[model samples]
Target: MMSILKADLLKVKRKWFWLLVFLGPFGVIALQLVNYGVRYDYLMQQEPDVWAGLLDNINMFVAPALLLGMTILASQIAAIEHQQSSWKQLLSLPVQRGYVFLSKLAVAAIMIFISSTLLFIGTVFFGIGLHFGLDIPFLAVIKNSYYPFFAGIPILCLQVWLSVVMQNQAFPLAAGVFGAVFSMTAAFAAPDWIPWKWPLLVGEHDPIWYAVAGMITGSVILIAGLMDFVRREVLT
Candidate 1:
């Protein structure tokens, strides 16, 4: 498994996928720059708690950015196999198909986690640049930026599954875009039922409940996808 995962990582070392990881979080923070660049004083006054206002602005784009990032990550990873016509070659190996799926999943998770971590750092840099103060909201920043990752497990699995089942990136990418759009509304209308809304739900009242639900639900979806892959005779 480790060998396979390592092989997968080496495949994309020079790809644009790495750029997308930085772009996801940096793009979100970029919006905040414009928001504050034009009206730094104005937005600061809106909320007495400086961190609240800054976080609010930062959170606005996190979900959308995350959605797009996940979409591209899944497509890019799947493309590694499709473009190289490596599926048959990989499956022909003595290893169980499950390892292949697991390798893909691990690679996807690591890529996103690194992106999310970069996002946290980017957020902090932007926050400090705006002079929000040295008394930072450490817990809030970490929670708000990263908790969504746990919630996005189902999304990660779904995107990966779609990518594997369908060779063309269109289906998976489209699903990701649609999910992001749906997330904006679902976060309020139906968080519990919708995985897309889980990331944005971090700022909500009693977010832990939703996060837990997302984990459990995401696990089910992930397992289902894995099993489906194991039984998959045709690699798209």
Candidate 2:
């Protein structure tokens, strides 16, 4: 499994996969930069707790970015296999099929985890620069930055499953796009069972509950996808 993961990591090195990871968090911060840039005075005056306000603003876009990022990351990873017709070659080796599936999932999740860390660092630095004060709410920032990723585990699993099973990347890509769009309104309209709503902790349940639920749900999806992937014939 380690060897498989190392090889998969090598395949993606010097590739656009890294760029997407970097961009995911940077894009979120860049947009916030412009937002505060335009109304620095008004925003500062309107909000008593600027850090909270900034985090709130940043969190608003995090869910959509996360959904879209996972979609593209999964598609790109799967594309490498599909485009090169390498699945059969890789699967023919002595490794279990489950390892291959899990390795790919690990790569995607690692990238997303890095993106979340970047968001935390970026938010802290950006908040400091904005003069939001030295008394930062470390807990709040952590929640805003990391909670969504934890809450998004199911999405990562589902997107990867979709990408791996379908030879046609368009279908998986389309589902991802739709998921991103749905996530924006999910807090208002989606039910608790909707996976898209988990990231934002829609319905206002305990924040930690969303993260816990995401892991449990993600595991089920991941296992189901794995079983199907192992059993399904690869004709191409």
Q: Who wins the lDDT comparison?
A: 2
lDDT string for model 2 (149-200, tens) is 9888988998999899888999999999999999999989988888898888
Model 1, residue 145: distance off in Å is 1.3
- Model 1, residue 21: C-alpha shift (Å): 0.5
TM-score of each model, paired residue for residue: 0.94, 0.96
Candidate 2: 10-residue stretch with minimal lDDT: 198-207
Per-residue CA lDDT of model 1 for 1-236, tens digit only, reads 99989988998888888888888888888888898999987887799998878887787678877877888888889888998888988999998898898888888889889988987888788888878788888888887788777778788888988887788888899889998887777756763656787888643556666567767987888899989999889684
Please report how far candidate 1 places residue 199 from its true position, in Å.
0.8
- Count of clashing residue pairs in every prediction: 0, 0
Compared with the true structure, model 1 gives a TM-score of 0.94
